[model samples]
Target chain A: MEILKKLKILADSAKYDVSCSSSGSKRTNQPGGLGNSASSGICHTWTADGRCISLLKILQSNNCVYNCSYCVNRVSNDLPRATLTPDELCELTINFYRRNYIEGLFLSTAIYSSPDHTMEMLLQTVKKLREEHNFHGYIHLKAIPGADNLLIEAAGKYVDRMSVNIELPSERGLRLLAPQKKREAIIKPMTFLTSNIAARKAERRKSRKAPSFVPAGQTTQLIVGATPDPDLQILKLSENMYKRFGLKRVYYSAYVPVSHHPHLPDISSPPLLREHRIYQADWLLRFYGFQADELLNEKNPNFTEDYDPKTDWALRNLDYFPVEINRADYEKLLRVPGIGVKSARKILTARRMHSLDFDDLKRIGITMKRAQYFITCKGKYSGQTAMEEHLLRPRLTLSPPKTAGPEQPSLFSFSSDVIAPEDAFSSVTGEI
Target chain B: MLDFVYDGSFNGLLTAIYEIYYRRQVPQQLLSSPGQTPKLFVREERIITDETKAGKVYEAIDTKISSRSLRHIYYAYLSEHMEAGIWIYHYLHLGWKLGNKLDLLLSDERVHRIHRLSQKVSMERHRLLGLLRFQLLRGNIYYAALEPDHNVVELLAPHFAARMAGQNWVIHDVSRDLAAVFNRKEWVATDFTLQHRLELLKEEEYYQQLWQEYYNSMAISSRINPRLQKRCMPQRYWKHLVELS
Candidate 1:
């Protein structure tokens, strides 16, 4: 097949992986290299689906030896399959890099042959891009789970980030969907690289010229809504992974129904809203001071589409409100519903001069509609309703304010009529 | 109300600010122009731009207040908003009065306005760094043309200088008739225009086609959201992107 035809098929096959971030790498161009990684990654463009296209996400080949039911590139699927030669792949990367089409390459593949052979192809292509082509750009290579540890370690030396998709949430799901792939095949490489990355980081910190290995660290993806896995189980696994594996991120790809296998759920569309909630919960665990059990317990096994996880937590824990915005410390302020990390920092900075009122809070970019119920400014509540759960629940769920309420007070007008003192007083009142 | 008319350069704006403090008079406007109308009963004065005075003022801000505040003033000035100069004058005036705690006064309208302007300008610069696409022209030169809302072409040059150090390229800001041309060794800003049509390499069209195909195939059909796409890559920037075209 022509390379153009191969590119379309390969990219279409790879799109289901859905971990296309190019951040957390500060790799600079070598003395004669062509490109570099921005400290805060750059998105070249957004696709029609509104996903950032930061990298040239394509497969080395779509020919597979395994039939994972949730995947589009499974063996039983009768679709056009193609592979790119290393030289062709390198040529496309350099040309695209010159034109600024992508931040770097995100190279994944189906198991074209045995796991060892497929990994060898990935390792060679990356080494060629780094050595012969003099390319110092960001690369995120997928580790063939059952491949040898030596091959995984060698490839880590040349790429910014590497990942092995924990294809299903649990062992039973993996056994039902993809019987050929072993769970140990995935966890073994993850454990190996985590140690290597830490060791290299410590060595580099001690000496300026020590060789670096996977300097951008590692990340992994989980297919949400694929198995009958509760969000509690998924989040607990993620929290454990973050601690045990030292993983950078745990991506959740809402199961897009690609196959009609009996083991898989019969869904018409991807569970996009459910995926979004999982990501929000993921962010809270990583950035905000929240634990998995705190956000979700046995009784509440899933996140609601009505409110975010933080707001849900606040609604359940009523005593936490109404937090005094001026007196709350940074950690306490972060727990409020509408105050994000950025908004929290802004409030702290702006409140140092004087206690902030509702007007100043709005200027500082707090989402007062949601936050007003959870917080108090100068010991005064400003929400549309009182701080009762029943009173505020519907208001929070229905986001828009009243369309035909009393007109917003004009900027020049006071809340109460501010009559002139001369007009209010009887100036010439003298008893006869 | 008093007004000062000076040349529309950053240094000139700084000189007008120096004159604002020299006369101890607060001006209602700082007009840099061939055509600007003053309010009724307002007096106008022409101010010459002095490099020495501008330097002294910049040095004082850098030394006394903070380098970060100085950077904020510079970024805000690049925004080229009509009232940016006057707002910056007020900010710096307050900076001198407040000493080191100037930026922390975010509740003050004048300081907040300047911060917003600086943030806007820097955000545009960051966006253009990613959105600007380079097309390969004849003679082995890479060219990109953009029309940003702010004067941000100069700010993008340093990043590309370190990025594509071995190649020759030009980043042209068609709206303002300016370009940053970088040779293999160094970069320089010069007046630039497209007098006639230019030519591209024979393979340029093929790569552009591949990119468009990749862009289309990457977006899953079930989740197409044009509004979010427009929000991230605004419609104003679609004119130059090959994939979008």
Candidate 2:
């Protein structure tokens, strides 16, 4: 294909990947380098959706040998196919980077010809940019599942971060939606990279000269709502990845219908609200400190559609409430509904100097509407106690209707109130 | 009742604080204006710019609270909130009472509110460093203008020179008409104007094209959340956004 035509085709194909965040990497421009990576997130561009676009996210090739049923670029799809030569791709990225159009590149592809061929082309493009063009900016390379270990290792050496998307949650789900890709193909590379990363980290601990391998670490994406796996199953897989594979993040892309399939539901679009809720739950896993089994099970595999994960947890475990604000441990303080990481940290830091009363807790910015039932500041409870053990649905429904806006429901409204008490507690504790 | 009115400048504000502290006459209201008439029962004070008084005020605040806290107070002033003056007064009072231990008052919503406003101001200033787009004018002076929510015009002075040190640049806050000028060697704040027929249209058009191209390339049509977009980059500021224009 001609260079310009090839560029458009590859760029359009690569646009589907949403995990283009250019954060968690800090690289200064080398002596002959052309770019810099900020520690904090930088906006290279703002999309119409108001999302920050930092990287020139594109695929090297959309020509796949494997047929992933959900993927539009899968081998079976009769789509126009194109692939950019390593030099052609490198030139495009460097020109864009130099012109201040993009911060770096997010290079991914379908299994073009074979995993090795696709991976080799990706490594060539990135290595050429680093060695020839001297481009030192952020590069997030998508490590192809079942690719040769050497290619994956080569990608790690040049790119700031690498991610191999798990695509589906369970091995069963993988078989149903994308038959060619097993759990092992994705997991094996993740396993290898994790060990490689650990070994590199160990070397760094001993000496300062150990070169960084994927300084931003590894992240994976899980397609939500495609299969029968519940949020619990998804979170379990995510938890295992975090604990065992040491994956930095497990992105949940709400399964947007790309192609018609017998096994998949004939829906207009993936449930975005469900996707958003899963993200919140995922945040609970990573930062808020929640566990998977604590959140869902075979009986209740999905999130409570009515309440947030934390609020649901809080309601389920109501006996834990009325923990004295002045004496509760940091973990206990974090469990109070409406109390966030910031407020919890503030409470922990403040109680060092003075005894906290109900007024003090309010002053510290606790949303008493939700936290009151769960906490007692110096043994003072300012919240309604009767609703403490009530299921979130009825209690949240009881808010006075004296004031209501057209767009925004009352803060306690199920649709509007995101950080439900139980959900909040679960996320905060990393409990299931 | 004593009322002290000062020019809307940090130095002038500091001078007023100095007079209040030195004179030991507590005011009924500390407004930031020059010519407003005080009530018949009130004592009025006109605040003129005095570097010595400003220094003394800075020193007193630094000794009482902390240099960092004083900087936050200045940041709070730049926040342009209607209650900024009151927040400053409360901040000063709180500083005197708690000293450096005031950060521990994180649970106090009032203190937290002021700190949040101060943080907002700082965040805006940092954002402008990345967002500010300069256009080369007729006089070889690279000019970028903004109507920032915060008083970021002053905050940008230290950065422009380091990045674009070779060229003369003028970053103007069009709403405030205050500009940060770097003359290749030294940088200072000035009230600069378009003295010549310098066409901003060509530069504006170039930026418009580039921004639109980037915007078009980046958006995932499936994930178009205009409401969320509007919440982040408000429609009020769309006139200045090259992409939207």
- Every model: iRMSD: 11.9, 5.7
- Per-prediction DockQ: 0.50, 0.30
Q: What is the clash count of model 1?
A: 0
Native-contact fraction for each model?
0.67, 0.34
TM-score of only chain B in every candidate structure: 0.95, 0.85
For candidate 2, what is the TM-score?
0.84
Q: Report how far off residue B162 is in candidate 2 (Å).
A: 6.8
What TM-score fits each model?
Answer: 0.94, 0.84
Candidate 1, Cα interface RMSD: 11.9
Q: For residues B10-110, what per-residue lDDT tens digits would candidate 1 score against the true structure?
A: 78988999998899888888877633554578788888999999999999999889999999999998898888878888898899988778888877888
What digit string (tens of lDDT, one per residue) describes model 2 on residues B1-245? 67777787888878877777778876665667743443788777777878899998789788978888888888988887766765677677777888888767776655777788889998887666556656656567667777898888888777555434556778878888788888877789888765656576564455445445545655656556565555445565555555566
Q: Where is the poorest 10-residue window by lDDT in model 1 chain A? A: A423-432
